[model samples]
Target chain A: MSRKRSRNIFIATCITPAIMLFALFMVVPTFEVFRMSLYNWGGLSGNKTFIGFNNFKVLWNDMRFIQSFQNSVLLIVLVAVLTIVVAIFFASVLTKEKVFATNFFRIVFYIPNILSVVIIAGIFSAVYNPRTGLLNSILGLLNLEQLQRQWLGNQDIVIYSLAGALVWQAIGYYMVMYMSGMASIPESYYEAASLEGAGKFKQFSAITLPLIWNNLRTTLTFYIISTINLSFLLVTAMTGGGPDGSTEVFLSYMYSQAYSNSTYGYGMAIGVVVFTFSFVLAAVVSRITKREVLEF
Target chain B: MKETKRINTDTLYKVFIYVALITLAITIIIPVAWVFMASIKENQEFYGNPWALPQGIHFENFREAFVEAGMGDYFLNSIIVTSLALVFLLVLALPAAYVLSRFEFVGSKFINGFIKAGLFINVSYITVPIFLMLLGWDQSLRQIFDSGFFLNNLSVLALIYAVTALPFTIFLLSSYFETLPSDFEEAANIDGAGYFRTMFSIMLPMAKPSIIIVILFNFLLFWNEYILALTLIPGDKKTLPVGLLNLLAADRAAVNYGPMYAGMVIVMLPTLILYIIVQKRLTQGMTVGGVKG
Candidate 1:
């Protein structure tokens, strides 16, 4: 056998199974989601009547769907901005060699990222429990009892509470990303900046910020994508989208529709919208961040 | 004179950094520590003084969590699903990544892109379709297995998890393989070693760091995955997260805060330990994968 033919055979043998599985599980089912969006297929029934774009029309008129989308968008913006700012701040501090107990602080901060969402929600639920929770207790200790209110139960504040929990959970991961990016920056820049008598904040703003712009962009993209797809566990345990559906992100809303309400077709329509939003947002961010590669 | 001035500034910077870090640590630790303390609090104490330290270590809560909540079975079920999924991911992704990274073949780029595209779609977006597919498969299994005993149908769920882990596995392994020098394979080829033997003996062993990262990340993901298990597994075969949710829901009208807290702690320990052990690798791997241009 020729060498080229044998290599082709090897590649074919290796790729076939994965290709088949991908088609069956991922590609086909994605198409199936699109197909189901066009039908009136409640989850349990064999009667799947064709109902063209009607599900999408229903979704457009659905106030809950609109609210869910708005909530998701708000979450994306809040989390993306807060996480980046916090991550960059910590990364800058930690990367300085003189920082004491840097390893200990890193591990402590990263613990939340490692935790399951269920556990995180459980802990935060205790912390924000209004009556006996830590936040209210602290408020009482500070003699601000009148200002203390139910954190998760208050409709106006539930989304902010959820966003706070998410930012706490995620800042560690993004900090690590920023730290890695900072590590890759040449030491000469810092030395030169110091030689030129650049103040700490000036060095950060003028030197480190632009140098790690790529990492910042990547982290922003990921944070946005993840927040948009925020799931049932966080929302359910923390607030159950509570105080009258105030905390319902798109994914949780879609989950409730499909599983809780058995509105499968409408849920599928929401799924399609989620897919488009994520894709377009990612594409735009990727394009915006596509700059000439920095060698250093 | 300049050196002394620089030293003073450096010392000041050190002081500032330590202050910031200590504050961040407190913010992170207090909530987790509160949860731990709350888990061991007696029912009365939990209600009366949720923030205070537990008066006594309530080992009974753990016992109750295991016995009343069926956490033992759920833990085993999770182990079975996560391990099987991890093994399947490694086996499938290893050779596929090797071939894609090393060989130039028709449709290879498209297949690589196909693997990556899975990561783009949120898992929830595909949940309805996956649930429908599994239901269909369960019906077929009943006809084939002929037992009407579908409780431990975690194998099918494991298959789905393997697919979910594939994108990361393939992406990481392929990149790692790309970094491997072709000299070793060439030397093995000169010695008449076949492709499989070369891969098993040379490439696989060399990719140990990548393999560990893949296993740890995939295990963490599959272990805590609640939505899929909730959808796929029958009521009796509940995994830990699902069981915790069920326990929470059982007394929906009343808050049985003790067992719910106990269940959360029990479910969290494995993941917490795994993270501590693999902290460095997990953080580094995520950064590289997430930030690479």
Candidate 2:
């Protein structure tokens, strides 16, 4: 029952497996990726030659890498903004007592959130199918045929199409988050505001939004991380960064370079850059939203 | 002014709100509906007008997708890997989470932060190094077992799945355990229950709901996972999602689009069923975890 003995027991019973497995699987491999990024390793069965920053310098000159980076940034911003707006709007309605079928609609909206990304990606690509697809067909049927564009093919619109699909899947989860945040807000405030002749929009801006500000902050962080990764998944499944890499995002391009081309060092270099890029973005987001804009 | 506002513009605004909500609902519903309706149609119907209703229910398309396209094998493999990974992830994450939540130590905060950092490091970012690592492990593993063993070389994928699921599961579970009262631990302590004994005997059962939530979330994620499986795990031994991608990528011209859609439906079936069963818990769990600091 000695204190030090108990401490040793705590360490033994608790920390070892978690730290050990994480360090072995996660930490070491992460370090190895960094080291390999410094070398010209050609993946498995390939030789390694340490070449400092060569891959990075080459990445700078690579237009595809730059384009993919642009695509990732675009997705991050678009998904965050669109999901927040849609979520807040939907959440406001659902949280009201008079909104009939609120729970039913909430669950209905969440249907896409619970489904797998691969399947959703398939569903979306089919929706964008050029000939008999839902989008183009609807456009054609409505006599708006001239406005229909090749949703996934026309390089100009492909990234936006991908972003739209992401926003569709993402909004429900955020909506629910906003719902939870709004649930915690006191009803008296809204009632008082209503009696003061405030309208629904006025009540939302004056009351619900400020109350859920912290929740929104957390949602923003979640958005930054998941949106970037989700972009990678969508591109891999739907386009494989295709139509001549028009839809390429950061991770898909890295995946192709490493897995497809077996340019291990180059791909690892991209990985390092992506890791750093995400880390900085997350830090910036957390910092920017750290100050509470409104206090209840 | 209040009476006038209530009579006209307020009603107009309420109608606008209702229309917007219904529009958003359609956007979410139509895609899944399209997939379901397409699954029942023959290729001719699908190709003719995908938006149109199916002429007759066709189970044959599902049969073709399950048998001819090798979806059954891929589905089984995905199940095995996702389940095995969840087990290992739980075994590894729970004890750490329990200790971090209940006990004090010098590096507890550091450890918590360290593991949470995994979220920032996307698996795609580190896939090359991890792939090489698995490939090396497979080399040694193959020598120990016969070369013809089906999943012998593929076991490393389950491990990777566990690692990817680790950060969030641990983060969620530790916080969940934190919300439980300390009296449970003191009660165990007074009864002479050791740390491991206390966790398995009490905390595991007590924290079961959160654990289930974490498991379901991770299961959905691993089941849907593709790029890692595509990169690290090679060949026809791949999981369901990558398998579907391969089917798509092979040749669209030669593909039977009907069966392909069926395969997509088959792939989506498990998650939809699980969501239906645990619909309430999924929303609550995700929202709670989502807003966690």
Q: Which candidate gets the maximum DockQ versus the true structure?
A: 2
Model 2: chain A TM-score against the true structure: 0.93
The alpha-carbon RMSD over the true interface for every model, in angstroms, is 2.7, 2.7
Off by over 4 Å in 2: A1-7, A293-295, B1-5, B139-154, B291-293
Clashes of each: 0, 0
The true-versus-predicted C-alpha distance at residue A225 of model 2, in Å, is 1.9
Candidate 1: clashing pairs of residues:
none
- Displacement of residue A288 (Cα, Å) in model 1 is 4.6
- Candidate 1 lDDT over B1-293, as tens digits, reads 99999899978877877777887888888887776777787878866755677899987877778888798889898889889888878877888988888877777787788888876656667877887776676677778886543334787778778887677778888898999889999999999887778878998999898889888778878888887788777668888988887766663346667777788888888888888887888888886475211
Residue pairs of candidate 2 with colliding backbone atoms: none
After TM-score superposition, the amount by which residue B229's alpha carbon in candidate 1 deviates from its true location, in angstroms, is 0.8
| lDDT (C-alpha, whole model) for all candidates | 0.80, 0.81
**Chain B of candidate 2 versus the native chain B: what TM-score?**
0.89
